[model samples]
Target: MNVLLLLLILSFASTIQCDIHTNRIEDTLSTEANDTNTLCKDHLQVPEKVRIDLYYESLCPYCKQFYVKELAPVVQKLMNYIELYTYPFGHAQMKKNDNKTTFECQHGPTECYGNGLHACAIQYLPKMSEYVPFNTCLMEKWSTDKDAEQCGQRLHLNAEPIRTCANSDEAINLVIYYAQETEKLKNMSYVPYTVINHKVMDPETDLIDSVCATFEKPPQECKK
Candidate 1:
């Protein structure tokens, strides 16, 4: 009778241990599932970058007007929320002659020269804070002097580097690069063409509206 009682007690203890092991595995799996859910929720909350690509030339009168009137304000307001990339070759094609590359513009030779200066500004100075004002000032004064040396002087930007870059190999390549970019857009029909988040914006509509519409999480100012 004593031996039988000892065997029964041992069996009961083993059953209890088995139950505890099973409960531990269930608890571990539940914790792991909860952790995965939390990670997925956090990842989904992160915001995506908004892209704005502007293709324009310096001396194109319509492009200049749009820059001054339409784009500047929206760029100033949504600077943080959007990524802006400006390409200064509009409806222009590049060709090689006498071991040097030359670009032809829609407007004229003067427009071509002005566009070169703008490319120089972009190359020599990458900062938008300085480059935007310089571009605006140059556009305002473009009719008087297509070379834009005087505009550089007026804007307090150094003119010599810009003049040097106008005819340099780097500037030529940059303009060519921009021209290639313009060519990639299937619906590109004219200067001042704007693309927002890889989609070509409507020609009849203003791009500022698209900028506000495309943000994944619009800022409070945008809501206003």
Candidate 2:
């Protein structure tokens, strides 16, 4: 009789222990699931993009160098993190004579035409992914009509729309709009003027470093 009683006690204790162990395991799993959910939410949050404004003319050598050498290469890597605005009018004056408007560029008539091409590209492309490469190619050489068409072809883009736009009054209007935006900068006396988040960036500073400094959480490319 005593043996049977002891056996019963042992069985009861074992069942209680098993239940406690199972409860602990469930609690542990619940805690782990909550932690995973929290981590996922943090990981999925999007970061704010940096704003960059470039004021330059098509024919300026310094502007061309900056666009082709510095800006274009880094743009693709940082595209996700940047909002780029390009203004192609630099020291270009607009004069209206008896319902006809004429422009005189600092670099002369050829430059005015080149600036129109740039404005047209921006108007037609509208996306940095498309326009940046096209502009980079154009800036690397003389921005002639043939050069524009060639760049468009090299990028696998249809050049007809861009060509049509360049010859239209719409292109002139776009250039005029850029000229107005350029005029807003206080005491601006230079081409290739770069603004990062509304502040003028120093020309001597490394472009990447200057851009990375503005980010609250710099990207992986910035680390490299």
Candidate 3:
């Protein structure tokens, strides 16, 4: 009886181990096989150490427009010389839409509800780090049409985690840290401020002109 019990326990443990191993292999294979590209408006040809930090809230229509109309084109032209980063502000606390108390669709272009989708985006950053083109697509969808479900599905993201993060103090503070630290390091006094090669640029002129001049390969670039 004792021998039988021991044998049964060993068998169960072995089965569990096998199952775990199989699942892990499947996960790895799935991830490895995924080769999707992310689409961003600004596809900067970034050189190492030349980083750009853009601060804006997801709900801010102005930010969305700037990204689509200006930043995306500039980045695409200067892809070899610019590295882009994001800082989200304003709707950090997941304020619900006035009409939809449970979850509000605040803007037409973005697919967010001031809820978990935002948090989920941050949480899943690890899985998404490699997919640059998708980030652009997600942002583009959110900017033009506020369909959180469609946007999430478009990016292959889960909604639950994003909502959870939007309400989380830790997540808020983390985003805050990124914004504040960026401001401090780059001596930024405003949002949409671009730091290029240690110079603080006005979002309107300096940043735009700098990117253009770099692509134009002008020996003497205009300083805005």
**Which of the numbered candidates is closest to the native, going by highest lDDT?**
2
- RMSD of candidate 3 to the true fold? 15.3
Q: Give the candidate order by descending lDDT.
A: 2, 1, 3
**Model 3 Cα lDDT, one tens digit per residue, 154-198:** 757554454456556645445545445544553444445555644
Better of 2 and 3 by lDDT: 2
In order, candidate lDDTs are 0.72, 0.82, 0.47
- When 1 and 2 are scored with lDDT, the better candidate is 2
What pairs collide in candidate 2?
none
Question: Each model's TM-score, in the order given?
Answer: 0.71, 0.79, 0.47
Per-residue error (Å), model 1, residue 93: 1.9
Worst 10-residue lDDT window for candidate 1 reads 40-49
Tell me the spans in candidate 2 whose CA falls farther than 4 Å from its real position: 1-44
Question: Residue 155: error of model 3 in Å?
Answer: 3.5
Show model 1 residue runs off by greater than 4 Å: 1-48, 143-155
* Top candidate, metric TM-score: 2
Candidate 3 local accuracy as lDDT?
A: 0.47
lDDT of 2 by residue, 1-224 (tens): 99999999997886665555444433343655434433433444434456788999899999999998889977978987787889998888888899877899989998998898889889889889999999899998888889988998899998778778888898888888888898899867887889997889999886788899998789998988
